[model samples]
Every structure is written in structure tokens, then in C-alpha cells.
Target: MAETILVTGATGTVGSELVRALINRGVNTRAAVHSIIKGDRLRHFNPEVQLVEVDYHRPASLPLAFTGVDRVFLLTPFSDQQLIINQQLVDAAKAAGVQQVVRLSAAGADMEPGIQLGRWHRQMEQYLEQSGLSHVILRPTSFMQNFVNYQGQSIREQGAIYLPLGEGRMSYIDAFDIAEVAAAILTDDVAKHHGQAYTLTGPQAVNHTEIAGIIGQATGRPVQYVDVPETAARQAMQGAPQWMVDSMMELNALGKAGHLAGTTPAVEQLTGRPPRSFQEFAQEHRHELMPA
Candidate 1:
């Protein structure tokens, strides 16, 4: 019997890329998405990807999504709904006779509620362990693509970046690399990785000022870093919805305490290559980092 793997958050930045890698490998892929529109968009890679709409708030819809799937790629949306969503998936996965789950979790997920997202992911990781399912937790640090976020404003209008991070070093991993690792775990019988947790990070820990200098060199503009109070930074994002506002603030607080500096050999161990550097990420998406 051919085993099937259902990937949640298939429309998201990481899941979307994993879906492609699975298709290229010819894995029996199941895309569990929040919207049919998103699933349909992903069908471009291969019509073999079975698309199913799954809202974890409604767990009844999940058993059907999990039917005939041997493994699952569980990615809880990083929002208010993460805990309930993870709980629902765990319950449904147990009920559906699923074999394994590769959870997309946050870095520094210790038992003591670490931070906002970190806390919830730790809770979910515990729940999955208690559920007795074969599981592998992939905890990745900050994402390099987030720098693309500041590109528009910094390159286009701001001509500089204002963040609370100051010179705090961070090991920002690439989303695509994270997704590839997820796909590898799902398709392999490498039992060594099961019941284990992996932490992924970029090749180097660099500061925001260094990032500014890198962008300045890449874009032919003098980009400077302006550090502000965390309160002021949160206030600057007042237009962001409550969940995002709270999440970013909690993350910055974690950064100030020196959490994001953690690095690992897990990326190369799994993918057989060193994780992408900030410079490589910046160069590949320079257009996104530069103002139009």
C-alpha cells in the first residue's frame, strides 16, 4: 500500500514550498488547506496533490482529510488558534490511525512557556508526545525572508530601518530549507529521526546593523539601523491585528534575552548542505528587498 502524507498550511510560505518538493519527489501528497482557492493554485505542480479544506476549529472535517494518510505534516497557524488547532489535529490523527507527524514548531520550545508562539508550540509538542504518535519536531529559528518585509519601506521610503533589535544577533533560517527538511522526514524510513527534535538555523548569526550594511551594499543606498523602544515599535505596528502585534513584541523580547542566537548542524545533517546565508537570501530576493 502506498503511504500518503497530508501537509497542513499548504498555502503558507513554508508548506507551499514543501508541497512542491513532495511533488518533485513523487510522494503521494495531500494538501490540507484553509481554502480551496489556495489548494487549486498549488495544483500547478502536479494534479496528484489531493486538495482538502481543513479548518482545525472544526475537527470533524479532519478525519476525512486524514483518511488513508499514513503520515501528516502538522503546521498550526501562528495565531490565536494554534493551541486548539494542534489539539484538534492530535485527536483526529489518533482517531484516523495515522502513523507519524512532523510538527512545525518554534525554536527554544522548553516546558516553561517560553514566549508567545514559543509557549504554544511547546504545549502542542507535549500534547503530541502524550498522544503517543510517532513524531518529529522541527524547530526553526527566525526567518531570513522577514528582512524582505523591511525592504519595501526601507528601500522605497524609509531609506533606513527602524527596529527594536538594535545589534542583537539572530540565526535566521530560510523557510524553503525548513520545508525541505519537513518533506525529507515525511518520505523517509529514517527511523533515527523519529521521536527526536531538530533545531534549524542559518549559517551565521548577524546583527541588524550588519544586515543594513549588507542591503546598503546590495542596493547602492545608505541604509542605517535605528533602534527604538519595544513599546514604540509595537505602537508603530498598531495597524497590525492584535495577534501579530502580540507575537512580534514577544519575539523581540525573546531576542533581547539572546534566544535567536542559537545555531545548529541540523540543516546540513538533514539536507546535506549548509543552511542558506543571509547574503545568499538577500541576493536571491534582492528585488523584494529593494524599493520599486
Candidate 2:
């Protein structure tokens, strides 16, 4: 029998890509999505995919999603209740006899006195470690897709990228690359990756100014990076909740401090190929980042 795998956050960025990768490899894939409707994209990719509705608020749905799963790809969304949801999933996976799990974490999750985001991920990592089930943790830096997802509009309209990151560089990885690494480990020998944590990143570190230049070349436009004041950044996010605003500012501080600027070869070591570069990502997403 082929190995059966269940993916949480199946409709998300990395989760969606992982589902596609697993299907391509002919692995039996069950995608745990927030709604059956959201699984349409997965079905569009491969009609054979098994879709299960999983809502952490609805605790009973947890075990059913894990039933008969050989391995799991766990991704809890970044929210106030992230820890609680991950704990619930771990307990459910344990009860359902899951053989292993590949968890999505952040870079710097293990750092001493890190930011709230790192602290949150570290807490979950610890819980999974103590759970006794075989596990592989993937701690990836910021995604290159953030340009299209978060800053696309400004790049398109104003021909400028605005952030408080200053001259700090970050080795942002493509979510697709992260998914590829996850698929490789999930489908390969479990023993090799068991109890291991990998920090995934792109091949090089780059600052926002360099990122702006790349985007300009990719989109055939003139784009510049604007280093705004922290107060101005805070004001830009005024409509969001106070906690979320503070959280973003904390990450901004880390970026400005060059704390997020680091490169790793784990992606190449695990997948037998180098991670995607920001230039490639910008080119691929050129249409999305082009002028509106």
C-alpha cells in the first residue's frame, strides 16, 4: 500500500503546494481544509485527493482528519490561539497512531530571547518534541511571495516598496521550495529525518533595496525602496488590532537589526537542489507585481 499522508492548513500557501507535490509523487494525500469548498483548488489539481474538513474550534473534527494517516504535515496559522490549535493536533495525531509529523516553523524559533513569533513557534516545537512521536521541523525564513501578497499594490501603483527594514538583509525562501523540502522528507525514509529540525532559506541574503531593484528588472519598471519611520509604519497598520500591529513592529525591529539576515544550505542538503532565488521568484510573479 502507498503511504497515506494528511496535510493541515491544506488551503494555505505551503500546504497547497505540498498537496500538489504529494499528488505528483503518487502518494495517498488527505488534505484537511477549513471547508470542503476550499478544497476545490486541490480537486482541480487532482480529483483523487481526499478532502476532510478540520476546524480547531470544532475539536471532534480533529481525530477524524488523522484517522489511518501514516504521516502528517502540520501547519497552524499565525493567530492568538496558534499554540492551543497545535497542541490539539499533536494530541489527535498521537491518539490516531500517526507515525511521524513535519511541522512548519519560523527561522529563529530556537533563538534565545527571540521575538513573540519565534517564542510562539519554539513553544510548539517543544511540545512536539516531548510528544514522543517521530517529527521533522522546518524553520523557514520570510517568504519571497510576500512581495506579491503584501506589498504588490504599492509596487504596482507607486513603483515603490515601503518598509522599516532599513539595510537589513533576509534570506527569504519561496514557499514552493519549502513545500518541496517537506515533500522530500515526508515521502522518503522517515528514520533519516526523524527528530531533525531544518532551517530553510534561499541561496543568498538580500535587503529590501536589492529586492526593489530585482522587482524593477523583472517587471520592466522603475521601483525604489522607501525606508519609513517605525511610527509611520505603525500608522500604516492602524486599522489592524493593537496586538497584531505590535507583533509586526516587533518583526520590523528584528529586520532593522539585521537579525533575519542569514543563509542556510539545509534546503539543498535535504532536497538535493538549491532553494529558489528571489530573482527567480520576482520573475515568475512579474505579472502580479506589474503596474496595475
Highest-scoring model, TM-score? 2
Total clashing residue pairs per candidate? Answer: 0, 0
Write model 2 residue lDDT over 97-124, tens digit each, in one string: 9999999999999998988888999999
Which residue pairs clash within candidate 2? none
State the TM-score for model 1: 0.92
- Relative to the true structure, candidate 2 reaches a TM of 0.98
Give the alpha-carbon lDDT of every model.
0.84, 0.93
Please provide, for model 1 over 156-242, each residue's C-alpha lDDT reduced to its tens digit, 9 standing for 90 to 100: 577677779867888989898998888888888847677899998988888888888877777777778888898899888988888
Q: What TM-score against the true fold does each predicted structure earn? A: 0.92, 0.98
Question: Which runs of model 2 end up more than 4 angstroms from their true locations?
Answer: none
CA lDDT for candidate 1: 0.84
Residue range with the least summed lDDT across 10 consecutive positions in model 2: 37-46
